[model samples]
Target chain A: MTSPTVFAAVGEVGKDFFKERTTDTLPCQSTDKLFCWDWARENFDRYETPLRQHVELVLISVAIGFAIAFALALLSHRHRWLRPPFLLGTGVLYTIPSIAFFFLLLPLTGRGRDTAIIALSAYTLQIIYRNTIIGLDNVSKSAVEAARGIGMTDRQILWKVEIPLARPEIFAGLQIATVSTVAIATLATFARGGGLGEPIFGGELGIDFKTNIIIAGGLAVLLAAAFGLLLLWLQRLVTPWRRVETE
Target chain B: MSGLLSQLPFASIDGAIEFIFEPQYSNVTGGNKVGGIDKVVELTINQLQVTVISLAIALAVALPFALYLGHKHKFETLAIAFGNAGRGIPELALIAFMAAAIGVGLLNVAIALAVLGIPPILTNTFVGIHQVDRAAVDAARGMGMTEFEILRKVEIPLAIPTLMGGIRGATIAIVATATIAPLAGYETLGDFIINENVYGENGVLAGAILVALLALALELALAGIQRLLTSPGLKPRPA
Candidate 1:
């Protein structure tokens, strides 16, 4: 009842915007209840770890996906016949459901970030690989001839001429990979790698936690949109010639 | 032989086949209660129901709307926005989100799958109809055909292959997604893996392979349909 006790109570009350997750003890295991925040509270800045980890997972997956896809596409481009089978193999990989894909990798890698990355990269491979192949094929033949006439070696022609011309398509593929990976990495929760979906499947909060679900789901959508816009900006930066061609 | 195969660290090819074929006769019921061939067939059918019903719903709604949009030459910006937004949400995320709103059940899972199916079909159909030769449409118009008739007679035929591209894409994607239907309280091939207590390690491995095989089979079937649907003259020359 003294001044010191009053001050401590006020500070604790104000600390978490709402009470910490343990505030509510819902005994109702019944699914009939409306989605209520009685059991849930979002401390606004509590999402920092999930946000950082989600972004990291997405960037790493897309980076690895683009590199692997580029190599495969390049190999196929050189051999010509390898393109069909390469496309077929990756297409089959894409057709595997993301959850099932995770389980398939679970035994090999066990759990956590690496397993999530491998599965997500598998999903990204087909899109980037196909786009890379298209980008290379679309490089103007005359441009390749022009590069050769300038005494460029085969590797130099690819590095200097074809890849530069193909930048937009390759970047476009990266954009797709980035956005989708951000979205998919949310489910990295299932792989024991926590992300936005931690609250989404409701976990400790239970499925009926309204505020938590909104915060998590809304963040996931926002993450995807922000990442997508960043890619679009990067694409514009990397492909200034595209603007010239279009306008 | 099956016992030996199961003891292997990971699932072997022989294990998957034997699990599928032998479980019906043998005493090898997984903890998931997936007894044998009858159960496998049942789960397969359940998976198909989710896939087929959801796909049908998505196609029914998206196709007509896309064709109409193409006919009117409207909603191009909206279509592009929808496509981008749709691609940004993973199938698992969509399914879980729907489960929250509707509660978990077979119908809820099917609705989730349907939402997954819509964007590709809508995007592809819109692009397809838009890509039809303008001169042909102008000629058909000049011949006094109504807008609807022009769309049907001129645009729809030419646009079939591209429209089917959307269908093929959606079908394959939905079939894959349907594998998770069991996790949301609907029984499907995923039960083999999702109910870890029931199927244990062998179920998980065999289920993964079965789902993959089912998807590949669907892809092959859809590709064949895509070929059949493509106009013979539109088929590219052998390279």
Candidate 2:
């Protein structure tokens, strides 16, 4: 409508592209260097709370997910008709994206760690449940038959024979769930849950700061790897027969 | 709990539904009408565009390589490792890093999304083809089929379910990541979710609903395609 209006429109459009996030007082940050070691050294302490939050989010989510999924798997294994419905329910939960899931629960759960953990745990349900069921199904029929011949009860057979044999697949599911939770928990920031995503999404220096992105992103990757390795080690410890078989 | 729920912001299910169907006046937009079916449809199309392009690129790149590896029975560890590593790369970080470093647009966002798609496809394809019955391949070979023909007519057919599983996983990941494409300046369905200042809370809820539906629909469509492509004989018969 006017010259001032046109200029203002142009400035609004170009601001994200043209504006410098940092002042020239800091040479590395102002120059838009790929990674500023000096800036990182100074600002690295800010990532501590976010990193801790990220770890807690992943751990709590995966733990709750594994519990629910494992219980469901056992229940469905006994009641054959429940299997399909359980699978469908968890599949729907899994289908919803983490970001959307966060918001969909916003009204009910409110924005916080509780909302994030619920969504993240829900996402894990399908994967872990499916794997656990598959693991149970894949147990050798002969072992069950032998246990029956020995006059073992159905519960006893399931606990002793089927579950023991299903260890590898069950542990595999746990590993996958843990790793995925580690990655997705970074989005917990959207729910005001606070995680590594806070730093990447411009906690202090803003998203334009490559150094911040590198530190936050790298920590997430490292966290995933750490959880993955920890799960693998735990798996080996719990499944002594697996070690023997591999050896 | 009900009392707590009533006190929360943006908890209006009815309001979100109305926001999806009709533009509403927004104080954030200075009383300008924002969101509605038209804006939702436009953004949904943009989201689907990025998702489809990224998936196509991922399939084109990962399929051949995975198939070759499966056929040769080589580099099993490498294929499997990629699957593990890929799962660990946080989607939020990947997109933010891409936007910050490589600059953002449809292409950049698509590429970032594709990076998420490739590993699942590669791992599933390799495992699927590798696990195909050796007898089936030998029979195809005995019928004077070339290696390529055997792969096309026998191996791929047998591996359809597993291959489709991978594609479904990739589709889910790509579609989910595409919801964040607005951060990269691509104006996907995430625009409503991200620019809450203009679109308001109702639009945010609507965006979430639409994204969830879109993902489920894509998954269902892929599952249908997988079933259609599979040979009739391979279909499980009821006792």
Q: Which candidate has the highest TM-score of all? A: 2
* Per-residue lDDT of model 2, residues B130-226, tens digit only: 9999998999999999999989988989999999999999999999989888777788888888777787777778788899999999989988999
Q: Would you give me the overall lDDT of model 1?
A: 0.75
lDDT of 2: 0.86
What is the DockQ (computed on Cα atoms) for candidate 2? 0.42
Q: How would you class the docking of model 2?
A: acceptable
Write one digit per residue (lDDT tens) for candidate 2, span A40-64.
7787889899999998898889889
Model 1 misses residue A70 by how many Å? 0.7
Clashes by residue pair, model 1: B31-B198, B32-B198, B32-B199
The 10 consecutive residues of candidate 1 chain B with the worst lDDT sum are B24-33
- After superposing candidate 2 on the true structure, give the runs of residues whose Cα lies further than 4 Å from its correct spot: A1-27, B1-9
User: What proportion of true contacts does candidate 1 retain?
Assistant: 0.29
